[model samples]
Structures are given as C-alpha cells and as structure tokens.
Target: MTTTAPMKRRAILAFMLDRPGVLNKIAMLIRRKMYNVETLTVCKTTQPGTSRMTITLREDSDDKMRQVIKQIEKSTEVISARELDMNESFWREVAIVKLEADEGRLETLKRTYPFETLDSQGNGCFIVQVTGTSQLIDDFLKDAGSDSIIDVARSGFTAMEK
Candidate 1:
C-alpha cells in the first residue's frame, strides 16, 4: 500500500533589489513552476535598495518545492529566499467578513466574536472588520455558521520575517 501526501501550504519570503520589474520576476518564476500562489505581498524594506516579497502556495512534494527555492535563489534580483512555517515563527492575516447577524442578534453576535461594524444602514445586513491569525478567523467563521453569511473576503497570509 502506498500513502499519498497532501499538498502542503508554505509561506515564502524573498528579499530582492528594489527596481522596476522586480515583482514581475518573482511572479514569472511561480508561473513557470506551475505553482498556485495563494497570497502575495510586496513592499519596500528598511534598506533603501531592497524590497521584500511574501508568497504562499500549496505544494505536493518537498522535492519540487526545493527546486523552486533553488530557482528563486538564482534570480539576479533576488537577494535571499526563505520558507517559513507556524512552528518557526508567528504569522497573521487580515480579512473582512460581511454577514447578516439579524437585527436582534447583532448584540449577541458581537459579544460572541471580535467584530467591528463597518457599515450599518439601509442595507439588509452589516459589514464587519476583523484582523487576526488565520486560525482565529476560521474559528470565528465556524461559530457564525448558524447565521446567514452575506459575503466573505480574505487578505491572504502576511507573515513577519524571522
């Protein structure tokens, strides 16, 4: 009997030279590798000449992941590349979840979960602002399962480098 491994989601951070077309270089690499990037964030780093990029993807095997890592390292614009996981460090992501908690149940729902009213008007429901770790967000959503969820939007994982 053979056991198949599940696709593992990984967070990758890369420091690169700050210049035009830098982001394209990273995106192209992922595209070439046929890896599906779940979320990606790019911003200027403290160093004036450098920038940081964070990417999350699901991989089926470590071997292919390693190959992609090697490719990233070889890129002229990329200074360093790293793969991060929960055990190594703390990470968090922000998301905006909009749902209808019912007019009367608003108080009960807010008390049960961490939520801020974004908009409450003539609309049939309310918009809530939420920011936390992925697990926390998922738990909150699960608890709200009994209620009617109007909409959900997620800003994928934004991790802090070690």
Candidate 2:
C-alpha cells in the first residue's frame, strides 16, 4: 500500500488576548511544533486591554491545526482563539514601493495600477502606495516590473471573516 502526504493549506488564526507576550508565546508554541508562519499581523482590538493576532500558517492537516488553536486558546493571556475561514473573510494588505520612473511613466503607472504616488524625487525615484488584497498587491508588483523597483515595504495582512 502507498500513502501520500497531506497537501498543505493556509490557515488563519485570530487570537483574542488581554496581556503582553501572548503573541510571542503563541509563535513559540508554533515554532516548537515545527510549523512555519507565512504571515502574521497583530493589532489592538477596539476593546481596551485586549488585542487580536492574525496569523497565517501553512499546514497539511486540519486536525493538527485545530490542536494548535486549542493550545493557543489555553494560554493565560489568550481569551479565545479561532480560525478564520478564507472564503468568508474580508482581507487586506498594504504595500509601499519605490521605483524609478519619470513624469510620463508615473502617469502611465498611476493609470495602470491602483497605487498613489507618495512622492517623486528629482533623482528619478518615485514612491507609490497601494492597499488591497494580498493577491491584488502581488499582481500589481508582478505587473509593475522589477527592473524599475528601488525598494518596497509591505504591511503583512489583516482580516475579518463575515
């Protein structure tokens, strides 16, 4: 008999916490399990003294992922932890890129990509900002072309499932 390894899928975990180091502890727990994080985003919740952590992990088994979620929820600082379904989630990411372009090219770029010009230096460096889905940002970068890119800064991702 032959068996195949489980295919890896992306899982997002939202952690509701009331104290500090919870993020570190959660990450350490996952690290101890040898799972790699693809993207992690943390922010203060609207409720005071509580925060939310949005973590994306690449895992093969749903059961194992659930177990990890349980571990996170078991922590003293974590009030609750749950998986966010991608299908029912609203997600967003922001990216700022600096590229080499002139007045004409910048105009063309502004029209082509959903990016705003932050500043256009006299030295031919144009800084642009974009915010949207991860896929949309990636597609913009891919189509933006690499040769002109001088630098890039991206805010990982944040999501809420509806």
Candidate 3:
C-alpha cells in the first residue's frame, strides 16, 4: 500500500524586475517542477522597474516550497522570493458580480451583500463590485444565490505579511 502526503496551501511572494514575460517565465518554472499554482497576482511596485508577485500554490511538503523559492530567486530578474503565512498577513481580492432583479429584489441584495454599484444596465440588471478577502467575497456570492448571478469577474489573492 502507498501512502500519500496531504497537500497544503502556501503563499509565495516574489519581488522581481518588472519586464515583459516575467510572469510567464515564473509560471513556466513552476509548471516544469510539476507543481500547480492556485492563484497569482502581479503588480508594479513603487520602484521604477520592479514588480511584486504573490503566488498561491499547493504542495505536499515544505521542502518543495524551498526548492521553488530557490529556483525563482536564481532568475536574474527575481530579486527575492519568500514564503508567507496568511494567518499573520493582510490580503484582499476584488470581485464584480452582476445580479438580475427588480428594485425590491435589489434591496434584498444590497442588504445581504455590501457591494458598490459598478453599473446599472436597466431593465432589472445591474453590476456590483465587492472588495475584500477572497473568503468574504465568496461568502457574499453564496448568500446572493447562484440563480440571481448574471456574471462574475474576480481578482486573485494579493497579500503581504504584517
């Protein structure tokens, strides 16, 4: 009989040179290592030619995480790569969901989920935006009901340790 280790989620933050194809290269590296990523967010940093990337991945052991970090940091474009814990961090994701309903039903939605108006197409269709943790956004979607959902656009997790 074979026993397999449990897969756990880990967040890795990388500060790298901001250049075209950097994200693609990093993703390819992870894939080459036979690992899959959960969510990845990349944005420019305060430095003129630098960017910060937060990657969520699932791995069976911490040793693999260290290997991935080493491979990432070895890249000329990558300045640093480190693992972070979400439990002691600040992170958020944004989602835009469209709900279809009459003004009365809209009130129910507003009360049920606190979202800002993104657009109102009229004829009982509207787009609303929610910005918060991924869990919070997911909870809002659950309470809003799938039947009422017209569309959904979500951003992945972006984070920093406190």
Write the number of the candidate with greater TM-score, choosing between 1 and 3.
Answer: 3
Q: Write the per-residue lDDT of candidate 1 for residues 15-82, one digit (tens) a residue.
A: 99999998888888899889878889888989999998888898867788788888998999899998
Best by lDDT: 3
Position 82, candidate 1: lDDT: 83
TM-score of 1: 0.82
- Deviating ranges (above 4 Å) for candidate 1: 1-6, 122-124
Error of 2 at 139 (Å): 1.4
Task: Rank the candidate models, highest lDDT first.
Answer: 3, 1, 2
TM-score of each model, paired residue for residue = 0.82, 0.87, 0.89
Q: Model 2 lDDT vs. the true structure?
A: 0.80
Candidates 2 and 3 compared: the better one by lDDT is 3
Clashes of 1: 0
lDDT of each: 0.81, 0.80, 0.89
- With candidate 3 superimposed using the best TM-score fit, by how many Å does residue 120's alpha carbon deviate from the native? 1.4
The residue-by-residue lDDT of candidate 3 on 54-143, one tens digit each, is 998888578889999999999999999999976888888889989887888778767866789878899888898998887789998887
Q: Give the clash count for each candidate.
A: 0, 0, 0
Model 1 lDDT, residue 148, Cα: 66
Worst 10 residues of 3 by lDDT: 105-114
Task: Write the residue-wise lDDT of candidate 2 on 1-162 in tens digits.
Answer: 999875554656565656767778888998888888777888888888888888877776788988888888788888778877778888788999988877888777667678888887878888899999888888878777899888889987788878
Error of 2 at 58 (Å): 1.4
